[model samples]
Target chain A: MDKLGVAEGLINRRKLLGLASGAAAAGIGLALPELVMAAPFEGLVERARQAGERQVVVAGGTGAYGDLVKKHFYLPFTEATGIEVVPTGGGYGEKLAKLKAMTSVGKVEWDVITLSIDSLTPDVTSLLRDLGDCAGLPDVASQGVDGSCLREGVMFDIGGGVLAFDKRSFPEGQAQPAGWADFWNVKAFPGPRALPNIGNPWWALIAALEADGVSRDALFPLDIDRAFRKLDEIKPHVTVWWKSGDQSQQIFRTGEVVMAMLFSGRAFRLRGEGIPLGISWNGAPLDAAFWAVTKAAQHPNAALALLDFIYTRPKAHAEFAAESFGSTAQRGALDFLTADAKASSVLQPANWSNIVRVDREWLAANREKVLQRWSMWIAS
Target chain B: MRAKPLAGSPFGGRPTSAQEYGPGLSLLLVTPLVLLLVGGFLYPVGKLFWGSVFVPEATFANYARILQEPLFLLVLCRTFEIAFVVTALALLLGYPVAMAMARVSGRTAMLIAACVLIPLWTSVLVRSYAWIVLLQRNGVVNNALIETGLTGTPLRLLYTQGAVIAAMTQVLLPFMILPIYSVVRNIPDDFVRAARNLGAGSLQAFFRVTLPLSLPGVTAGVLITFILSLGFYITPALVGGPGTLMMSTLIGQQTTELLDWPFAGALAAVLLAATLLLVIVFRRALALNKGFKLG
Candidate 1:
């Protein structure tokens, strides 16, 4: 009887495993349509050949950004012009140094680069091609003319740093923190907090001052020393200094900390995942992630076309925005957003209005000094 | 003309070119390895060390900056202190476990050995996450503690220095154990028997006869654990608070966030120098120990 019972159990276990395998196979089968749809874009290679353009290498295109560039830019460009996008992502300084190093060695590999203001601000004038030359191109000029996108490189997305909190950790009917000031306030709320482990301590410092009753406009002529003092007070309370957006979400989900400073879209993703995360847009600093053609690009025209395509395709912009939790530079891009995407994203005008427009040029120039002081201050 | 063929009677075989070509052959065999070491490791390290001082016009500014800042010294001291404590803990825990494994017979010993290695094989990140789950307020350890009436509340175990030490020790203990195990296994039974014949107690025999013989392995384990602990980033980052941030993480932030390669390289050079110095000192001390010479 025992032997028979064991055999029955074995048969049931096998059936369960078989069911799991079948489901996995079905998942692969479901993805086949998307693969088939993307297949036609391969014609871009022949088009590129006909146009006499060689392969183009797209640097810093490895992450989701890289994936997007490949799908929307590389594949289409290859079909249209025959150039290939090579994806490479590393630390911004390291990547720039590598590019610089390659140029010095006369072995430049990347044809295009997608960089943020933080990356392109300092030496970008030298590293990047003057897309200004391509200003006559309608799509390029249109996308590139947006307030944050700037005069040179085209802005692809409006990303920012926002305060994210776990709603469940806070009491019901209590006022949610509306900004950085409230994020640093511990006594009233009383829980562990996490902060960004990187970047300007300036934001948190500003938040601390605001918590102490300083206004937003007073941030400049920055009581740099006073900000450090303010940060020092709150430093002990931070449980985890999160390194990445994903780490921030994980911290929230695991209840590692009640609140955190996070990338704007991560909070949206957490809410989608059913975590009770709330984004407080008040005093959120807006940052821009822009794309530019590398000086060494072999297919600058196709790269321009890729940029134009992104600007012109409202649907694609909308889809990217919906997935990434940021907004497109195109004015009417929000019309395509789903209700769920709009409700959670920081892209809405109301949220965008609350964000302080950061002076990227000033920030970039003084960033090194600010960071050194911040690191020293944090350790102290 | 033969001149006794240069008296090649050292071996029965005829004189071969290999005998005369020993140095050249050795150089040929070692050249690739040396080139690899120089190109892959030395060049980067040399560049870092040089850049630290040279970037600001051959100034000692980087070194001076480190000295002038109390935070750097404090972190460096704390890092060494933590590494020392971790090394002591690893030796304490690992020595007995290794001894037990060496003494025990059959499948159970192999199973325990496998269990130790299993954790080593698993991703450090995965283990750290598991630790977070286990150590959280509502997690298994606290729940068990509460249920057993050990405490009225769950102790905060996830983000303390204790947590960092505990996690670090767990991760580093295997490195300490394997070397000691190899040494302990070779300890002849007759030595202990001989001690017993001299009317020494079992504890005495262990302390005098057995212990000193195991010093080489213990020394090796200490070196491994100490050096490994110095470079620890992930464990402390996951299980520790702001105060627990180490030199490596600080260097990482410098590169990724500040985009300050020169400073990052400087910090790395400092850490590398400190570790190398410690290892050298440790080797000299070990060499002076008389038992090690025979062992």
Candidate 2:
């Protein structure tokens, strides 16, 4: 949490660990002397072993993306710490329900879980433990981009709802949309376009507000009325209000929309499959998934160890992020990625600089109100 | 386990039928259904009612909120509007098919029946997605329009309210056709022939004889289509644009996205009440035509 030096941190950890001078070698700092400079907890592996913790249950997603998480993070953590990784995959709703059920009965099955702006709130906070300041997460604290570490969770990966256009419309050296304002200019960039109206409406709202000449810094505490007004202009042109990521790609592949807002990961996959797609990071609204520990976790130390292990290997992080067409918190991970791999990665300066973080905190509080308003606005 | 012999019993406890097939057997035959209804339908509905009124300390707030918000009422109105439109379209489009099926040769009737049943057999989700493929900007409909010079530019058809109505009608057409087909198929051929013989033109004979006799099936078909369309979720969500938001969409949003179970319960209850009210009105209207009461 302290952006200053390590002199006080070492003393603080020393007292926190309460390890005698003779046992200094086995303290938190020395446990991973080579990898972690300042591990969050002392003797995490030793404590987990003592606690008889072997498997860390996670509500990890399924399919190709889930496999990537397992290969890149879980397997290595198991190898390094001797804890088996069990990923019981389900959708956000299912997982949240399970979490609530587990906690209500005082027996949580999952040790760690994923969180997004959608599942982050709606009165579901008591289920997760507040990782105070995330000070123990040295990697996230030091190397992560701004707002990477928070009281509730640490961001494991980041994706964006980006402006992905067909390159044929704006070929090389041709004038291209630089931001949301450009995205809104149908006269200049004429084509049927797509925007998501999936359960998540905030992404479209952010894009609309940005197009309405609101500064990126002043976007939060959203001007709902202004956003809807801007959306009115683009509503006619959005031929497809795609409900899923697959549909988003399908619309583009079939030329349903020459220019549209699409999930960055889906856009990357389309480009990889030989589509002449161009992704502009202009005012891209970031959709990040955070790694959170449950309050009812049986093995809290084991959960922390798994989270800590994520930041240990930058190369694995890069590979996982690239394969999924997303990005990790660590800027260093981007170094290991290929040029083609970094095309949709937030590590690219164009994307990273222009990226707009979704105000998750605000969204969490006003989810129902905003959703009701959105339902009314879109339908009306 | 004997079925009670109550004269006004809706559950078919009349002594006349139960006595014919040993009372116990008649009651036994229906036990599984009774249990299923009690467990699957009634229990869940009871729970939903309880949650709507009881969650957060026995308050009517959930139901009140639904009434308070203009959004809920707007969606409810829109849902009814879509249902009415779908029912009207299905009737207009389906009556002819039903008539053909009823009057055609047996082999042709079988083929027409197959056409109606095939789409009904197909998953609603798949059918909805198929509509998207056909109506998409670069999809078959647009491509055909462009090729034939029907329009200069591809029309935005897929995500519009019109698309929703079209898809919903297509989906619900089978429901409308089968009922009318069955009744029309049973209408005596002599009735129309007799009317025509009695100084009636072909059109007059058909309208007076065929149409009046087929009214029962038409009423039944309208009831089925209207009820189903009121709760339509997938077709509207897939093909309908923002302006076409329906009641089920709002209910789904509350349950899944917001996890507002109480509010979702209220929404469901409102839909159920509205559907029941409409069905009752339809039944009362149908009742005026003596001996034409539907099950």
Candidate 3:
């Protein structure tokens, strides 16, 4: 009986040790994948390959822009480097917030993120690693990259907010609105208008000041009080304050608003769809979208490789620009763009001179205060 | 007449029953769920509350700003106002459905239940989009209205305060229905029959006995609907116009557009506090009504 008891005790102890070791194994298993995923990808291309980590995630806008990036940039990059590229779509603000949260938590998921000029502020730049020394970084200045993309990010495509109106409302032989001044002329325009309420209100504010007779050169350091007064004049007539790109498109599609401030690419798409859309590029703010590598990216090398691939291969850049109705910053890419595409592009010489470049730095600095005032104005 | 032995009592004098494992064993069984709630819900909420004071320096500045700012205050009041309207509409619409469900059985009950629940299964975005289609200027409703000669021009129905309430009520109606259905179903038919036999009309029996008994469920439904409506963002955002700014919308702007986490947290904390205070007041009022009945 005593011998039986000793055997049972030994069996119990062995069971306890087995349970403990199993738990330890589970803990290690849980932690190991995150460690491998979080490791830097720079100068570790061979190591990454050995580990079979060949996928890089890229986050950008949805719909047409996302499709263009996938078809032209991601596919070509993957074909060249044998690394798979995954594209994730979200709003510009959402992506920025996600990146900030992910970096704070030290578990970066996206390798490359497309950012707006306004999002390239100091606070955001601090979270991004300077790509100056990234392998195969392009000469953005020589390539005629927009000023917004000259630092920190690779400027991929350029589009601007243009005054687009329903052709049905302002058809052939009708006096179409030409610029911000014409847009603010309610008596002449004589229809409900829409303006973007997304992100910063800089576009609307600048346009308002311009309508109020503030010259382009003296637009910066915007007079807030004066802008509000001008906005109030048109507020009663402004029917829709569109909050998304899709919503802006919808407002026009449904004929809810006769005129709207819309992204040029969307206007181009609408025109292509035979939607009878009229686009006025005069006084439009030239906006550039840039691809930047996250500081905590797990696949930084692959991201850098993709960025280089986009710039060096002018055909892919031009293809994306043509299909998406956006302008490529790479000068070499322009050679591949068809005459029709070039005519539609804001970067074309005739349209380029009429568009205004938003002072991103000034806008970034005053973003908070301006947004506060904007919200107050909207509420009032 | 010495309280002549209660019917169905096995024991003569005092009843003897099996002892329960008590609170200790019950708590032990619930430990995993408690831990999950603590780790998941409570921890994040605690972190959010902490973030409010700590960000941009550990100060009450964020809270102070929210309290002082007229915009924040206006948004808060608007949030509550919307929630109140939504809750009242849900209760009104849902009570009839719940009554019908309680009255029916078998296939009919299942059909009613499915009607209530199928919407819950669908995505909120899809439902909101559906509302847009039905309410837009040139949408189905407006076309019908124009064809029927209701008005010469289509009414602006898509982005009005009424649209928000309608959509919210539709989305939250199920929440209000299920609770009342369960309670109304459980009420014994004998009570209403007895009331009728005692020379009471059917409606009088319903008002005196059925409605009073169903107050618990009504209270639960109202509380649930009101709280859920307060945090509603998408429905209001899609269906309502810029004029229909709610607390959650402001919080979203602060978090995403402005990257003002501290201020967002502060706004959330204020909202949470208000909800809790309202809940307490509601419960107190309920308890007082019950006390009056007992007295």
Best by TM-score: 2
Q: Sort every candidate by DockQ, greatest first.
A: 2, 3, 1
Q: Which candidate is the best by DockQ?
A: 2
lDDT of 1: 0.71
TM-score of each: 0.74, 0.84, 0.75
Task: Please give, for residues A81-127, the per-residue lDDT of candidate 2 as tens digits.
Answer: 55799988788777877888888888888999986745666366667
What value of lDDT does candidate 3 attain over all alpha carbons?
0.78
**Residue lDDT tens for model 1, B122-229:** 999988888888897677898899999999866678877888899999998899999888888778778889999999999988888777877878988999999999
**lDDT (Cα, tens digit) per residue for candidate 2, span B1-295:** 6666664222345456646798789989999999999999999988988899998789999888888988889889989999999999999999999999989987887899899999999999999999988998888999999999999899989888899999999999999999998888888888888888889999888767788778889998999999999999999988987788898887887887677888899999999999999899888977786453221
Candidates, ranked, TM-score: 2, 3, 1
What is candidate 1's lDDT per residue for A245-348, written digit by digit as tens?
A: 78788877777788887877777778878988777777776666676767776676555555555565566667667666566666556667887666544556
Deviation from native of the Cα of residue A224 in model 1, angstroms: 2.1
Q: Which of 2 and 3 is the better model by lDDT?
A: 2
Where model 1 places Cα greater than 4 Å from the true spot, the runs are: A1-63, A66-113, A120-149, A291-316, B1-59, B121-126, B136-138, B146-155, B250-269, B280-295
DockQ of 1: 0.25
Which stretch of 10 consecutive residues in model 3 chain A shows the poorest summed lDDT?
A: A1-10
State the C-alpha lDDT per candidate.
0.71, 0.81, 0.78
Instruction: Put down candidate 3 lDDT per residue, A122-231, tens digits, no spaces.
Output: 88998786966443354344455445344577877777889998878888798988888888998888777889887658889888988899988898888888988899
Q: Which ten residues in a row have the lowest lDDT in candidate 1 chain A?
A: A1-10
